[model samples]
Target: MGYSKDAEHVGALGAGQIAKACNNYLHWVHSASNVEALALAKRYGVDAEKMREVLLKSPGDNGTPRNFDRYRFTWHENDIDLVLDLAQDGDLILPMAALTDQLVKPITQGEVVRLLGEESCVYLGQTVAAREAGLDD
Candidate 1:
């Protein structure tokens, strides 16, 4: 716990939590971005799978190549909720997290794969419902 360590020496408590929440927010946003791109590819009759494979190879932060496996749904929904709640309690406004929290509310384990697409590490129920409804592909 970076925050815990910081608190011990620097009196930092919320900083680490805020940083973590923001990072989680990015993950949700990227997950949605990937899923939406796949859905659009499917609509255009493009090879969605191939596109995902290529995109994952594309550069990310610091020009590092994206790894598809990193996006796979693996986190339990409860974990996401816990972070969102923490962010809220700390007066942090993680819009993406708030939105993602709502999105994951009804998702089930079985639907995580299809909704997140390739290499989804964390399952978000909202992604599942959106995919199942033919809205997210």
Candidate 2:
């Protein structure tokens, strides 16, 4: 076995959705190495540089202030505050529901796709639950 193809599955599990919805607020995550956006990516396991590129180029408010963009949040603060910032305050819906459910317990793979959206499922055509959502394309 070469171990070259070894890959760890992140299973979106609501975390990916959190990364998606909070793109706008990414500038404020406040990690030492990664400005803020990258920190959020690390929180949920995403390529910071890739995330910044995809999200920055996508739609939504560029300067919009969301949870991830807080100027006052300290290092000790929790992620729920950040999620809530983008979700409830920023009007970011998908990540909110996922984050909320995630708080009670870890989100399932199905829940990840449910919030992230099927279009995002570039790998396996989305989660099994996503199939129920129906794929017209």
Candidate 3:
């Protein structure tokens, strides 16, 4: 942990906060990736729960990477805002993160399941309807 005033660690006051923001940003990326993948799976008739199980045992982080158990250590409500604030201050543009942020907003706001949203369901249904209507080959 970087402290404000100390000879031990050479850093300023916002150092710890910056570290936290970066970590949270990475968490957001991973969480959004998992949610998007699951949503796509459900769209194609694969059982969501079964796919979650498969992801958990895939590899890395002892299954934490694919953990669907919500509200434990997932992104809090203000986390993304904080990260975006930091990015703005640093003049950084995170386009992918920004895009994923919109994709997972409903889940974070508790409008749907923690990692799955009704929006995905609606989108998937629309795709199916279009296909049935011979919109695509």
Candidate 4:
């Protein structure tokens, strides 16, 4: 259960921060994609729980889906911003990171909890679709 073997010194200075930013960027992107997949399932009446179970056993599995309920939304925005800032400093173009930043900016802690909660099958996309369809909550 330990990842100590994965730890190593990459470079002289500031490399750790860059590595951390890259890790956070992947984490945020994966988390967002997990939610989107769940939302897609709900939309298609595919049984969210079953979809999640299958996803856990499939190649699509990641830490996000396995630990969905335990995820915290506090630092996602800041983390993505750090990534974008790093990309800007390097004069690199990262459209996906920019899109991820925008998509994650509007999410609230309560929304994530409610959407991904153990006893709940409702997702943000489901709610949005309902609203657009003129249905009542």
Name the top lDDT candidate.
Answer: 4
What's the candidate order when arranged by decreasing lDDT? 4, 3, 1, 2
Ranking according to TM-score, highest score first = 4, 3, 1, 2
Give me the displacement of residue 64 in model 3, in angstroms: 5.4
lDDT of each: 0.51, 0.38, 0.55, 0.71
Candidate 3 structure quality by residue, lDDT tens digits, 1-137:
44445433326986866776666767766666665666566656555556677777675233434444454534544777777777788899978667756655644434225324332343212331112223234
Residue 50 lDDT in model 3? 67
- The runs of at least 3 residues in candidate 2 whose Cα sits more than 4 Å from the true structure, single-residue gaps closed, are 1-34, 60-137
Query: What are the per-residue Cα lDDT tens digits for candidate 1 across 22-118?
Result: 5665665565556556556554445555666667666623211144334335563655777778877779777766777666454433343453354
TM-scores, all candidates, are 0.50, 0.20, 0.59, 0.76
User: Higher-lDDT candidate among 2 and 4?
Assistant: 4
* Model 4 lDDT, residue 123, Cα: 43
Q: Which structure is stronger by lDDT: 1 or 3?
A: 3
Error of 3 at 117 (Å): 13
- For 19-131, candidate 4 gives per-residue lDDT tens digits of 87888898888877877787666555555557778999999987667766576677997899899888998999999999888776655556555554433443443472212
Best by TM-score: 4
Write model 2 residue lDDT over 2-95, tens digit each, in one string.
4347644346676655554444234332122123334334335454345555655666325422222233333222454565655666675765
